[model samples]
Target: MDTQQLEKETLEKIDQIVKNNPVVIFMKGTPQMPSCGFSARAAQALIDTGENFGFVNVLADPAVFEFLPKYQDWPTFPQIYIDGELVGGCDITLELAESGELKKMMAEANAKHAQQDA
Candidate 1:
């Protein structure tokens, strides 16, 4: 496939990833024990907000590992999304946490997700 086709495919896969789970977390490891400091921080940010989230360890999925960067246009581990919208990476999450905005965002997202699930 050409670059454009590859990019499109990557985006479709990412969209499916988010749609498959209401509170999906694309991190370096499971929430219980994150493999990287950034992933740990992001995981904590979600927990700190009292949001129950699902995780995907890119370390475990070759296709996800290869395409995540193309999907997000960001070459980094521990990317986060809220209801399929790319919220940001670790630093942005941390900043939101420190500012007390993370909780509000997560709470709202959680409630929205809960409604959808009902």
Candidate 2:
């Protein structure tokens, strides 16, 4: 495939991942082994919520790492999405986690998605 086509396909795959999952994080690595401190903290924050979530390891996918910031207009790693919405990065996630809002938000997003799926 051509460069443009490859990028297009990657974007589509990202779109599907975001839309299909109730909670998703695009970080430098997986939740178990984050590549960066920011990614680790963000993933931990989500994990603290006790909700099941999906993740994309940017380090493993060059196209996603190159195109995600442009796609979401968020120029950073460890981007978190709740119900297909950009919920910001590490600091924001940590703040939400500390405030007890992250868990509530995760539950609500999960419930909403579950209803949609049902």
Candidate 3:
């Protein structure tokens, strides 16, 4: 496919992933083996929340890494989304985690998504 078409498809896939999952993290790697410190820390924060989350490993997909920032206006890896909304990167996630807000937010998001699914 052409460059534009490829980018369009990538963006659409990203949109679907973000919308379909209530809690999604677009990071450098998988939750078990993050590619960067930021990703590791961010993934840990989410894991601590005890809420199941979806992740996209940017390192595995060049098109997503190149075009996802435009999709959510987040210009970095380890971007967390709750209810399909950007929740910022590592620092923000850590802050929320420390404040005990991350768990709550994640739970609420999961619950809301579960309701939607049901």
RMSD to truth, every model: 2.6, 0.9, 0.8
Q: What digit string (tens of lDDT, one per residue) describes model 2 on residues 1-118?
A: 8989988998899999999999999999899999999999999999988998999999999999999997789999999999899999999999999999999999999999999889
- Tens-digit lDDT string for candidate 1 (3-91): 66776776787788787565677888888979999999888888887777778998887668788887768888788877677778899
Instruction: Show the lowest summed lDDT stretch of 10 residues, model 1.
Output: 2-11
Q: What is the full ranking by lDDT, best candidate first?
A: 2, 3, 1
lDDT tens per residue, model 3, 7-75: 999999999998999899999989999989999999999998889999999999999999998897888
lDDT of each: 0.81, 0.94, 0.93
Q: What TM-score, to 2 decimals, does candidate 1 have?
A: 0.83
TM-scores for every candidate against the unseen true structure: 0.83, 0.95, 0.96
In angstroms, the error of model 2 at 16 is: 0.7
- State the lDDT at 48 in candidate 2: 87
TM-score leader = 3
lDDT at residue 49 of model 1 (Cα atoms): 77
